[model samples]
Target chain A: MVGKHCILELYDCDHAKLNDEAFLRTTITTAAKRAGATLLNLITHRFEPQGVTGLALLAESHLSIHTWPENGYAAVDVFTCGDQTMPEQACELLRQELGAKNHALKSFQRETPAALATAVRHPKA
Target chain B: MVGKHCILELYDCDHAKLNDEAFLRTTITTAAKRAGATLLNLITHRFEPQGVTGLALLAESHLSIHTWPENGYAAVDVFTCGDQTMPEQACELLRQELGAKNHALKSFQRETPAALATAVRHPKA
Candidate 1:
């Protein structure tokens, strides 16, 4: 499995904007669509004080977000295993939608053990 | 917000073990509790061919996993923001529960913009 996993820390977003439930939901769903992820289910939870967590379960993989409005910060994680998913493009879309001033991203390539072992077996080939 | 995000790629797990819905659900839920995360909601989806996707939404943060049993592989994402949460401990728990032969972990620190910006402002204090 080729899982292009992307984790993003979005900073300095508008506090009010970060707290909007609808915006968070739609933005993640749209990102899933942009990434070519087939939506299986979507859930969004709003905290008592002021924060939101949204998760989109997809056939290809999943995308999730957690926001802290008080600090105007949001954390995002998008992992897709299929070949077609565009998680990076989705990140750009989210940065714009959240009005984040700056952000950091760390991505990982997740492969199956068999594949990794196979690579180790044929280091030169 | 200090978000300690851990993403794991578990390889060569027992396929039949991965297909057990209850185990998948409990593994994640327990991991949350171990991390001192308050459970908000939990959901698990089983794919047709042979896989499972579980998401545990916690007040402190969230934990999720997607399994590819055919490859003896699983992908895990655990993000916790509170200072009390012990994400690494949870990882060790999962590793034992899944009986993963090998695994890879990549972590990121998610900070609120104010905190990150403040650091940039004061370079050294």
Candidate 2:
């Protein structure tokens, strides 16, 4: 299967009042829906009164988010397969929601076995 | 805040013989440890008599795996930041564990916000 994934590292967030748990759940569901992801199940854990983290499995792929209340930072990862661009859209939504001042993002393409073999022979610079 | 992530999709797996739930948990933890991920908390769900899926949040990043017992297929995603290549290493371990004959993989670089803005303007063809 071929897929695209995005990893986001959000820094300088205002976590003290961002409704951590709610934000995690809402962001996952909303992003999944917006990207037309077929969600199978979701589970979230709120670490006492400090941080919150969650994971959602979707037919298209998956979405995960974590928050650090003390440091005012968070991280998000979204992966999707099929005819959709939900990860990118979700990133935009998260950017707006967190009111993040600065961030670092990365993307990866999971290559098929055959292609990967070829890639190893001729690595990308 | 730069990181790397890998997404894997396995097809034609042996679901009946393979221990779905056990595999899910083992793969997540082992892969995380091998990748030098700092474990935080892990949660897994087993869909009665059928499939299993799990998520592990690591200080380095996160690991997620899902198994489709009926179709003998599974998907795994591993992402890590810092001076590590755990995602790739984990993919290799998974391939060996699942006895997967064929597969597809892809990788992406999530440019920092500033780089992303530049990428958007220049675009990658």
Candidate 3:
């Protein structure tokens, strides 16, 4: 089955929130629920100085967040396979919850083999 | 910090191997090690009819696979931060281990805010 993947770059986020382990864990869980994804489990790691990385395993797929608190930045990935889920919704929730001033988002569809066969190819750069 | 992200699409993979949970778990762990990434933990789930989804939490970042055995296709994502780790190496190892006849890969850098500001922008489609 094909799926949708979103790569979100959040800029000028709240540094404190980004570094808070509990906050990130909650935010990701909430974001997954908001996106209509079934959260299987969440695993997080807090860096020594400052920073947090969190991943949520979903039945549909996964959602992850990696934060650079010093720069007020965070990178998020949301990929979900069934049509019932909306990955963009998860991105928006993260943007708002993380207090990002400006964000860049790239969304693309993962194609199945049959569709990929017919898809246009770009020569390796 | 900027990180490299690779989106890999495998076609004509070995169906039995794709559906095997144990094989995927070992393959992904070995692939991560080959890329010089430290493994944190791995979580996997197998679908009812025939399919498998596995995610490996790495100290550098994460690696994930979602397979559709009946279609002989598997989708993989590998994202890692820091210059020490090579995400592409992980992708190549997976391509070989999965026995994919043909594969498509897209690689991009997730830039920090400063670099993102000056980078070319593509208007929404």
Candidate 4:
């Protein structure tokens, strides 16, 4: 199956929120639900001095975020297979909750070789 | 600090290897070490009948893989923040271990807003 992957670069996020492990875990878990994905498990880590990293494992795929509190930056990835899930929605939720002043988002498709062949043969289909 | 993120799509792989949870865990751990990343924790889940999903949490960032044994396809993501780490090397190791006959790889840098501003102003520095 083909999947949609979104890479989000959140800038000028709230430093406190970026370093708050509990908040991040809640936000990521909520983001997964917002994307219409099935949450299998959620894991998070808090760095020694600062920063936080989290991953939300979903039945469709996975969502992850690595925050750099000192820089007011956070990098997020949301990937999901199946047409039912909207990975973009998850990215948007994270951006909003993190209070990013500015952000850059890149979205792409992950297709298997068979899917690529099908797209080539049936460009309109 | 700026980070490198690599997205790999492996196709035409061995179905048995794709579904082997033990092998995947070992391979991903080894890939992280090869990239000069510090491993924190590893978590994996095997789906009913077939397929597997694994994540290697690293001090630099994280590496993850999701396999589809039925279609002989797998998707991998390796992201690392330190300049000393090589995300590409981890991706290559995974590609080899998974035995993907044909694969597609995309790599990019994830820079924070501060870094972006510095890059734009310095231009050559």
Clashing residue pairs in all predictions, respectively, total 0, 20, 0, 0
Which segments of candidate 1 are over 4 A away from where they belong? A114-125, B114-125
Which scores better on lDDT, 2 or 4? 4
Cα distance off (Å), candidate 4, residue A8: 0.1
Better model by TM-score: candidate 2 vs candidate 3:
3
Candidate 4's C-alpha runs over 4 A off are A115-125, B115-125
Query: Which candidate has the top score in TM-score?
Result: 4
Each prediction's TM-score versus the true structure? 0.86, 0.64, 0.88, 0.90
* Model 2: per-residue Cα lDDT at residue B115: 29
Lowest summed lDDT across 10 adjacent residues in model 3 chain B is found at: B116-125
Model 4 agreement with the true structure over A1-125: per-residue lDDT tens digits? 45889999999999999989999988988899899998888888888677778887788879999887877889899998877799999999999999999999999988655552222110111
Mind sharing the TM-score for model 4? 0.90
All candidates in order of TM-score, best leading = 4, 3, 1, 2
Candidate 3 per-residue lDDT, tens place, B43-100, comes to: 8888767778888888777899988787888999999877778988998998998899
Clashes of 1: 0
Best by lDDT: 3
Error of 4 at B16 (Å): 0.7
lDDT of 1 at B36: 85
lDDT of 4 by residue, B10-124 (tens): 9889989998999999999899999999888888888866778898778888999988887788999999886779998998998899889989999988865555233211001
